[model samples]
Target: MEELDEDNMNEIKDKHEIGTPEDHLSEIMEEAEKYHPGYGASVMTGDVLIHALEIKTTSFCTLRCKDCTHLIPYTKAPAHMPAEDLMDDIKKIIRVAKVAGLIFMGGEVMIYPQLAELMEAYSKEGFYDRVGFVRVTTNGTVVPSDEFCAAFRKIKNGYVVISDYGILSSNRDEAAKKLESFGIKVNVIPEDLQWRSLGDWHHRDYSKEEAEELYRKCHGKLYLHLYRDHLYHCYRAPVMNEDGLIPHSDGDYLDIGSMSVEDLSRRLPEFLTGLSCTKSCFYCDGFHEQSPFVERAAQL
Candidate 1:
């Protein structure tokens, strides 16, 4: 290889620096037009499209990792949501908007008792057609069941995102192999993954302009939370809300159970844009680019 200069080395080192806040804003705003800016095309055509949203299936995980932004390790009584309710919510969401990437999230998706039922429902509803793609994450501790393997194969554009934390995620390789054998995509999370620690739950008391800038700049904004029937604009907010760490916000979340198609059409676009920073913003480290790093998957 040729000699690398200082500027070239710096560029490689800061690869994760996605860009400045203006870059993020420009990209989000530009993409908004395609994803029903007024919630128009999806509602009128039935050929739906909505910004990506993640479903929080459970907080129970195999390992109690330190400095988890979701604070998964700190949840005293991590529990699963009623599968029936989640399915209902999924159906309602699919009816209103096209999901970009319908993710099956959890404490440990493999351990969820009613996963088969949810997978069955996913197949039955033709979600494969409605979604851009389907993704399920795992930590490689649980072996893949034949039923789930079959269900995964049924997904037209589905993939497994796995992590290998040595013994903790021992079954990771097996899961990947089995998933691949079934003609499904298996994505191994890179070992050098970077996790930004957002600190403890207490409020930071950020001013309006500070909070707005913080909210607009972070990728946490993209990590929208779908808990119970509400769609929160930020992933950390709902988790922190459930943990009673952050004050509740009526304005920050969408009552998915209450909204009509027209209501959903208008609101989802706004929800995705996340223009107004919520109370969670004040308490959050903003998952900012400059936030301190936590070693990925560091067990408690």
Candidate 2:
């Protein structure tokens, strides 16, 4: 997928000198039709194709990192969705959409009890073609069970992204070794890696124009977070809503469980590409070039 073109967006902003929030939203959505990460119009006309899907299997983490991007620490009542619960949405998504990657993520996916069962569900039964590569992202706090390893090996196109946070993630190496032993691919991110501060749950107080501009500047558009059964343009939507930090807004996300596959195909592009910015955007510092960098995995 191509990155957002700041220059093109700037030209539109400069040329139109858009005034009203409603008007600017309309203009932005119209411009979004041209080209952007989630701006695939083919789903409306031809095929339902999604570049990627980040599925949150669990919100329960072992450590409480102060600057966690997903805001995992803030969730008062974190959850762990069973494989069976997730499979329904998985089945619904793959039914109409050709997903490039099926990413299973969490506060710490390694701790998710049904990891093995989830892996088997996506990797087998001709689901490979529908859902391209499967990925399991972990914080490397714990090693996987033998059953999980066996299931992971069955994935035709799958790998693990394990973050190594020095002493915090002592089992990082051992976990990778275990997965590799099962012939499962692994990518271990360095402990000292930099992280952008996603800020606390508060209103940014940006005006309509500024809010739209902030959305344009953000790079998180590609990080389409599927929380529970709801699909959101921003990854923080789930956390913000779950924690009651933000007001409820229907336009912010799609309730995928209630919608049909055809409804999803119709709304997916609109939801992903059409939105100027979600309410959660006001609370997030965002991941972008101009954003401030911070230390990684500083536990509270």
Candidate 3:
């Protein structure tokens, strides 16, 4: 093992910060338009009836799915959001942005003991009905207790969205049935796609051909919501990965209330014009998909 000196350590840290800089907001926005038309602009304008606000409840997962893209591999222990802080942020978003819904996502939200408390807080605030809907995206491994389910049942608009990997242990069907028994709407994402490993990240790779096939099978479309001061139409995964977890335009976590629809719309052209550098753009699926720059660069 070679010893790493102080200078060597600093260089490694710097490299990680610039882990993938060529990946820029402009390129992502352009790719958004190409892969999913009108999605970018719709999110910016809030024309879509539903808007998602995700609170990562627990940062750790009991099961290790190969293509886990939440960057869970980088840390040993997952972080949990304090219920108080989580509720405060939720209230603020609802009051300021007129958001339609809230999504609780995580390594596993059910595993967080305080999840029931957090949900109850929303109901107590009288924002429950106005909340439009509450959805939880989980890996479908841990089954919530009867008491937990009872609490979730109290929220009239609550539901669960379970992602089914092909692994049998996920027991997605059983989980959905159980949640439905409690009068909660259960949406199961079937395991139609195979998981592929990309370096340390595991993802469901839908090649252009595979994606088209999957679209037909699911009878739906893939959409992305890019959130800065507000949401922008996007596939969510790639743009957030490119922005390095902080909102690029304002150097803050995305705060929906602070943004205007017009401001988000105007940024689109700027994003398109800035996609010349190709370093960070390499990992994106949009690279292969058709786009204005892709056509122009091909000519050059």
**How big is the positional error of residue 165 in model 1, measured in Å on the Cα after superposition?**
2.6
Q: How far is candidate 1 from the true structure (C-alpha RMSD, Å)?
A: 6.1
Question: What's the lDDT for all of these models?
Answer: 0.71, 0.73, 0.48
- The residue ranges of model 2 lying beyond 4 angstroms of the native Cα positions read 1-45
**Better candidate by lDDT, 1 or 3:** 1
Report the error of model 2 at residue 102, Å. Answer: 1.9
Residue ranges of candidate 1 with Cα displaced over 4 Å: 1-15, 20-49, 258-262
Ranking by TM-score: 1, 2, 3
> Which candidate gets the maximum TM-score versus the true structure?
1
TM-score per model over all chains: 0.83, 0.82, 0.54
RMSD of each: 6.1, 9.0, 14.3
Provide the lowest-lDDT 10-residue window in model 2.
Answer: 28-37
On the 0 to 100 scale, the lDDT of residue 75 in model 2 is 88
Error of 3 at 263 (Å): 17
lDDT of 3 by residue, 157-265 (tens): 6678887755643667677788889898787766543221222222444455654433222200122232222333223232334334322333212333453445434
Write the number of the candidate with greater lDDT, choosing between 1 and 2.
Answer: 2
